[model samples]
Target: MLRRRRKFLEEGYNCALCQDGVEETIEHLFFSCSTSSCRWLVLGIFWNDGGNIFDKLSTAKQAFPFPFFMEVVMIGPWCIWKERNALTFNGKAPNLATWKNDFKKEVRGHLCRIKSSLHDSINFWLDAL
Candidate 1:
C-alpha cells in the first residue's frame, strides 16, 4: 500500500502511537496497534464477538437498543481515526481517557437527536461505558 511506502520516500511511515517494527498499514493501524487495540478492547465489552469492528457491527443490527448500538459502532472508530490523523499530521499524542469521554458524549448527543424511546438504550449505553 501507498502508506507503507512513506518510509521509502523519507516521509512518515511508522505508527504514531507504537512506532513498532511494522509499517502503518490499515490492519496494523486499526487492529494491531497497541493504542488502537486497547481502545477497541475497552469497547469490546459492548460489542458482539466477531472478527473486527465492521464485522461485529453488521452482526449487531438485530439486537435491541439499536440506535445506541449503532452510534457506538459508527463513532468509536471515527473518533480513533480522528485522533490518528491528529497524531499523524500535527504530532499530537493519543489520549485514551479523553477519547473515552468524548465517545460517551458523542453517543449521548446522537441519542438525544433521535426521537426513539431510549430508556432501556440509555441504561445499556451507560452501563457499557
Candidate 2:
C-alpha cells in the first residue's frame, strides 16, 4: 500500500522516496516524483504529466521497440520499488547508478528467456546505454 492509503488507514505517513513530505500514491511514487521523472527522462520517455499512469505508459510504449520497451516496463518500476524499500527499511539512499546497474543486470539475466533473434538488437541497445 502507498503512504497516502496508509495515512488514511493509520497515521503519519510520508513519501519515503522523495522525502519531500508528499503523500505517496502509486502515481506519485512511480511517475510524478522528481526521482521517477529523472529515471523516465534518462530512458528518453517524456510526457506532459496530464494523464493517468496507464496513459503515460501507453504513450511511452509508442516511442520504443516493443521488446525493449516491455523489458524496461517490467524492470523499471521494480528497480524503483526496490530502492524505495531499501531506503524505507535500511536507511539507504537512492542511487541512480545502482538502479541502472540493477536494471542492466536484470535485463541481461532475462535474455535467456527472450527470442534469440532479438538478442542482437537488444544487446546493441544495451551497449548504447
Candidate 3:
C-alpha cells in the first residue's frame, strides 16, 4: 500500500469518480466516493471504512481468499485510474454499478490468469473443478 501510494502520488491523481480529493486512499479508490454523474450514494463504500485499508486489502481472508484479495489489491487502483482517464480523455463517465461490476470481474479474471491456487493440492483440484 505504501508502495502504491507513493507511486500514484508521484504520478498525480485523486479518485476518478469524486474528483473532490483523493490521496492514494485504497478504500476511496476501490470502494468509496460517489460517481461524477449521480450525486447520491457512493460506488462501493459498503466495503470501505478502514484506516489502513491497503494493508487490509493486502492481507485479508475472511471473505476472499489470499489470491482473490491480491487480485483486488492489485487491480482496483488501476481500474480507478483508468476510469479517471476515460472521463478526462475520452469524455466518458460510467455508472456506479458499471464500475463495481468491472472491479469484480477484473479481480476475478486477474486471479484466474495468475493461476492462483489454494494451499493444498486437493483444495486446488477442487477449486479448479
- Scored by CA lDDT, what does every candidate get? 0.66, 0.75, 0.50
In order of appearance, the predictions have TM-scores of: 0.64, 0.81, 0.46
List the candidates ranked by TM-score, beginning with the highest.
2, 1, 3
Assess the local accuracy of residue 34 in candidate 2 as a C-alpha lDDT between 0 and 100: 83
* Model 1 ranges off by over 4 Å: 1-11, 45-67, 112-115
Tens-digit lDDT track for model 3 on 6-79? 54455576664575666546455555665532311222112435647665543343544334344444665676
What digit string (tens of lDDT, one per residue) describes model 1 on residues 53-119?
Answer: 6765566555543455555566777878888776665656689887788777776667756556875
Error of 2 at 24 (Å): 1.1
Candidate 1 has its poorest 10 consecutive residues by lDDT at 1-10
Candidate order, lDDT descending: 2, 1, 3
Give me the displacement of residue 22 in model 3, in angstroms.
6.8
Error of 1 at 55 (Å): 4.7
TM-score-better candidate, 2 vs 3: 2
- Model with the higher TM-score, candidate 1 or 2: 2
Q: The CA-based lDDT of model 3 is what?
A: 0.50
